[model samples]
Target chain A: MHVKKLRKNTFFSLKGVMLAGIGSLALSAGANAGTVRVTVAEYSAKTGPYFEQVAKDFEAANPGIKIQFEVVPWDNLLQKLTTDISANANADLSIIGTRWLVDFVEQGIAEPLDSYLTPEVKGRFIETFLTPSVMNGKTYGLPIAASARAMYYNKDLFQKAGISEPPKTWAELEANAKKITALGNGVYGFGLQGKEVETDVYFYYGMWSFGGDIVKDGKSGLDSKAAIEAASLYKRLIDEGATQPGVTSYAREDVQNLFKQGKVGMMMTAPFLANQIRDEAPNLKYGVAPIPKGPSGDQGTYGVTDSVIMFQNSKNKAEAFKFLDFLFQPKQRIKFTVNEGFLPVTKAEAEDKYFAENADLKVFTSLLPIARFAPVIAGWEEVADVTTSALQRIYLGNGQIEPTLKDAASKANAILKK
Target chain B: MTAKRVVAPYVLILPSFVLAALIVIWPVNELAQIASHSVNRFGQLRDFVGMANFRALLDDPNFIASLWRTGIWTLGVVGGAIICSVPVALVLNEDFYGRDLARVIVMLPWAVSLTMTAIVWRWALSGESGMLNSALIEFGIIDSNIQWLAEASTAFPMQILIGILVTIPFTVTIILGGLSSIPDDLYEAAALEGAGRWEQFRHITLPLIAPFLNIALVLNTIYVFNSFPIIWAMTQGGPANSTDILVTYLYKVGFRLGKLGEASAVSLVMFGILLIFTLIYVRLTTARGARA
Candidate 1:
């Protein structure tokens, strides 16, 4: 009797579980009609609250249309999207690094927005910022965030080192760094970032100034004479103690921190650092300037953008597009740009006083014309990794510039072939 | 035996067997499938290519270097932890004032998340404005601050040291449990026989705790071999992939480089290596039991 009762109990419990699962599935199916899920990359602490408020306001404006958001960190966004897509359970919309859009489009995971992007809506975006997300004559994504790099210098350090202005050329920068080093009380000049994301971009500032392209005529320009000279110049800076010690240990953030503490004379970074300084080190007087030009007067800066893309598999495409339309409005763009310290992506946002009159943002906007985006190619991340590794080897004095770069070029070429 | 009796054990174990297959076997089989195929960045499978993914990994110099480093990382952490834990466990097992406090302090690190611990270490080991450097300078230990994460030489060793530190608490706990299981009369007998402290440890405590030591060794080797956060949070196996172990390399390949096929292949290799180690360990232990 006891055994029979136990069997009956197990049977009823299993049936109950199945019923509950089916009921939840039915509920989700019903909810899916009006719900649009968006996976947003968390840019800062304010990113979540800002987006949540937007979603609330959007839902209020359009009754019966709910906006659900899954906020992921910047570092884990790609991983999350990959897993989500592989399982065929991705959100209706997502924010991805502009560089990764090529992969998304190649896999047919991104929905082209050309049909929904009317001329009036399209005219709102800066052409330069919008160009990266447009591929094969179709807009697969919209520029949600954009930033360009510029040189930041410590005014106090410059004054103490007997310099009246920021250096205008690499040669002058080196001399100025030496001067700052001489005034050392644990101070360094030319905060060189040798690690982490965009390490290749850091080297590219010099490479471009020396008139080398990342990829010239379908081959890697890493082994070009220009690249070699750039590497050599950076190495000389390290050997002379003009940059921070153990440069391979200092990522972009680390160098920025040193600049914030007023220990570093100069560092080239994104405009976000200006915002960071305002909050974290308000007393540190700083100046923004163009990246130092090469001997021949060539100059370049790295422009980065993150895009919010519509997934091809989205069930609620109309609802998602509606939300996106609301999001790209000047009002929404201004709030996002100001809160995140991103440069203005829309025309109206650019004309706003917060951006138009800002001295630091002026430097960044001026450089956008010469700014270079990461090349749109399959396996670009792999190419960037190769470049970063080769640069690291050069930075650590582990490999010679010529051979190390040559080896890295061949490796990059092989990847580019694929 | 009756037919019902013969089938009862299998019937009783069927549910757990199905669950195990679902959780473990299913995913591994799927991974094997992905490993043998050409997978895109999003893990969509393409043409089947037998042994090609594995061959590609073997050809990559970075992959080979990471494999060997992973071996060193596992051996260093496991060996260091065992050697350090034995003395610590013995000391903690002794009757002393504040023994509970000492044990808690020793075990405190294990209570924190591994990633959190690693992040704290990253800040403390920073080249400039780091707590470690300031403390060293304050003590006049060196004329200048050392860049701990600058290269593989210093960075890798410090990573190993941290791995050992985190592994100690768990290891010492296991060994302490082993120590308590040993009857006090054995030590008493050894002492009566004019055995010194060393002899008591060697003849009585050591042999008795051999099983526990073996267990700790196996578990620690598995944990340390697959450890990701410490190295990742520190150097990210960077400065030219010098400090990279297989797991970090797998992450780079799978996520960073978007080579899912090669990444799956690398994981299978790791699985194979661990499987072999566990098999050999089980064989040795069973053979020793038979011999005794």
Candidate 2:
């Protein structure tokens, strides 16, 4: 008898959802004029006004092109896209994370781009942007934006702590943080993401800056002195209270929230944050600088690329590729990046006066020449997952770095074996 | 009489059976097949390693951890539901003013969409600006914001708390239905006897509702065991895979890692485990009744 009531409720709720979801789709279908669909993370509201303007600019310039942008949350995007693609129901053009390149190729869900690339586009964009797509000699997506981690400092906080400028070395950064933290009013000098959702980003950048590589020679190289030093440094910071106490529990969003509230001395963040800094806290004085150097003068950070890929199932391939080609043009690329607070991938765009004028914008584009791309293997997501979890365990002092990474490497190797 | 009417029953049932097979039986059978074979993302042939998938699952260290976590989830969610609902349902069953309003408040979580519930809880548990954290810190009992969903050791407990909050409405409604069925005469007879309330409840009320209770408990356990959204929203089984249950592992294998075969094997194991548990529950309840 109780089950009957539940069944009634569930059925009615499902009916309501189906009605609303389908109704919205139908309403849009009637009004949309050749929508060029794209997907991005949900916090994209920072760039929303710019994109709306960009769409109008494109429509006015080209005529008869409409944009149907779907801002998706990072969570559940994989499942949602897979279901749509498997049903042959994908959008014409999609903004895909570089990590999706291999799976999209293996699934035959994305189109190869060699035939469509103009000589201009073929040469203008930096080679690094295309590296993820050229798996087994197949090109699938065009780079939309590239970002590498850079340290942003609270200029006012630095002065109050008697610091002159942003730290240029790891040691200096730590010292400044300690000084700033000594002020103490629910304020910590440095902030970073230490949560599980971002284990790789938090650990990998520090490891790489110290000249450590997790994998080499088809084996785990995590036992290197550089890797140990990196882990120890991260551990030392937490132990010394050079960072917020909640660093162990923080995510990127959490850090961003605190930073916007002017609660930290320095943070390593990507480019899109400039817009948030502009929009939410314009008075918050901050300076963007390259991540501090390691002892060996190695200064580096993680560079993630977001791209646009035409699905194999897209019926409007002809129109879509033309639009994509238009996007490849340098001026449009610069506009897209500027509007989105992303760094353009094209070499010419990187050298444009536009970047020269905005020093903050230039930092990311400047890193393109030397920044490292994550391993583009077919099972990289799994590898990333295992490596990240192991690294997290190490960072928390659960185990030695070498043994933890070795365990993760073996598990990842098994995943990548086929 | 010669209309060949014998085929009509089978013919009439054909569409429903076909739909059921397509929606339910086929996916289950395919999971079994996927557990045996290997395929690339495009469904292309790769390799067939038969029960190697099962072997990998058996050998996986994390699988054991996930199973243990699932056990905790099952016990906590089911136990919490009983503790919350039994007393509330008893009180609500009394002739009280605004009884409907009180019941609605108790059942509110059930009415909210799972997605909305996850979002609200995630914010309520956020390390910064989370309502619970602010309230606790403001009270001066806690000096700092509790990273409720951040650490591995704390992750499962936090999820269990959320599950307890969510389970209240469903279980209370079930118990309310059971309560309504009890005759007033039973309680009146117990009152006439020299028995107090606790003795009366054990001797009369509990025995009468035991079957319904069993049904609710078994269902709740199964539902909680397979729950995904709460953890997915709160931590994505994170802090360090501390809150990972079998479902999350299955997702990682099938979707993230593309180890479809291994994921299927995990799913099959889950199915088998649930089947055994349900059978045991059914047998025990029936045996008790038979002895009675």
Candidate 3:
């Protein structure tokens, strides 16, 4: 008797669910609407409502399309996307780091948006912001957020150290750092990031300023004279006790935290540091300047961008493109750029008067022209890891910088060749 | 009826047999295939490279260095764990006040997540703003702070200590279980013979707990050999790969570098090494079992 009753209930529930699904489908057909799912990494909790509000507005205007929003934390975004793609369960549109564009293209996982991009939409993006998304003459994604590195110094500390201006060159920067270190407080002159998550970029900031490249003509560039000089400068700063004592264990976040606490005199970071300072340390006085020039007056910093990618396996491409269009509208893009404190990827947003009037963001915008991105290639992360280890060796070990960098370059070349 | 009896038993164990095949046998077979082929970043197998991936490791200096370092790491963690566990296990097994509480306290580190342990230790050992440095300075043990994880020499020792901290709880619990199984009457009878406490422990307790120690030794060796998070979280095998072990290196090569073929080769090599160790260990212990 119990088995019969259970079987009858299961049959009725199955029928009811099927009827409900069909009823919703028919009702959606009457409205001629479809759902497009989108995922974005939450820049901060404060910005969560911006995405939901935009999605609601898009659905209201489009009438025929519903939007599904997935907001994930930054740390979990990459893993979630990779797993989704592997399982063929990706959203129609998603935010992905520009670094992964090449990998996505090589793997045939990202949909090439060149054909989908209207000429008007294509012209809206800053050309440089689109560079990392291009592989083999085809663009696979659109830049949604951008960053350019700059040197932020504690103005109060500089004044106390009797410095009238920010350092203009590498030598001057080191001298300034030393002077600040002698201030006799628990303050460190420079906050160095020596741990994971772009420790190599710190080395590259100096390397690029010194006009050195990691790869030249598909081979290692560590043996170059410029590379040696860059490595030497960092080593000297660390050895002279101008930087924080535990550099080899500090990640970018740690350095940022130190800067926020007024424990650091200077840090080379993105403009987002301004937002952090505004939110966490409103009273701290600071100044932003382009990264110090090398002996020859060459200066550059890494330009990083995050892009919105359409997945290859997405079934609702048409609806996804519609939402993408809505999201990139000048009105929406400007609000996002202002809210997120990221550099504008779109020309309209870039030309907006709001960014120009914002003093903190203006400093970063001025440096954007001189920003240099790391080589977008397969196995680039491995090269970065090797560079990080090599930098650690130079800073911590008794090894000479030239040989150490040379060894690292060769190791990087081996991975690139493979 | 006789034929039905055998078939019915096989039917009963069929689900577990399939599970074992899927979980263990299938992955090992896949690993074998992956080790022989060159794979792209997207996990697509591209070419049949035969033993080229394995041959590449013969010339790769990083792999060689990591292999040697992994041996030292395993020995340090396992040896330290044994040294730490024996005393704690003995103390916990004794009749004392709050013995149950002490046992739980001894096992608390094991219950805590490895990542949490790593984070706590990393903060404690931080050079400029660490509790350890502050305490040492206050007591005049050192005049200045030491960058424990920034230098190769110190980071290596710190990595081993973190490993021991995480492994000791498991080791102590296992040894404690062994200690409890010893009949109290044996010690009491020895006491009646005028045997001292030390003599009773040496003759009765030691002999009975030897098997448990062997178990702890083998298990700790395997656990320490495969351990990844504590070292990865703390140092990421940094300070010029001075603290790198095989598993962390494999993760770097596989996930970061996207060299699945080579990573598979590294995994197979690690597996082979551990398998050999386990076989020899089991043979020696089982032989001792037969003798006993």
TM-scores, each model vs. reference? 0.95, 0.86, 0.88
Best by TM-score: 1
Q: Which segments of model 1 are wrong by more than 4 Å?
A: A1-31, B1-16
Candidate 2: true interface contacts recovered: 0.42
Write candidate 1's Cα lDDT for A219-297 as tens digits: 9999999999999999999999999899999878788889999989999988888878999999999999999999999
Better candidate number, 1 or 2, judged by DockQ: 1
DockQ for each candidate? 0.48, 0.34, 0.28
In the range A15-116, model 2's lDDT, one tens digit per residue, is: 332353453355346433466665544334344565566567666777776766654444434544654453344567777678778778877788888888
lDDT of each: 0.89, 0.73, 0.80
Q: Candidate 1 chain B TM? A: 0.95
Error of 1 at A252 (Å): 0.7
By how many angstroms RMSD does model 1 differ from the true structure?
Answer: 7.9
Query: Residue-wise lDDT of candidate 3 within B1-292, one digit each (tens)?
Result: 9999979999999999999999877978888888899877545678899999999887877799999999999999999999888888999888999998988887888887676677677778877777989999999999988888887689888889889888988999889889999988998889899999889878888888888999999988988899876787677677667778998888777756667789889999998998899999989988988997
Tell me the lDDT of candidate 1: 0.89
lDDT of 2: 0.73
lDDT ranking, best first? 1, 3, 2
Per-residue error for A100 in candidate 2, Å, reads 3.2
In model 2, what is chain B's TM-score? 0.89
Candidate 3: residue A408 Cα off by (Å): 2.9
lDDT of 2 at A306: 70
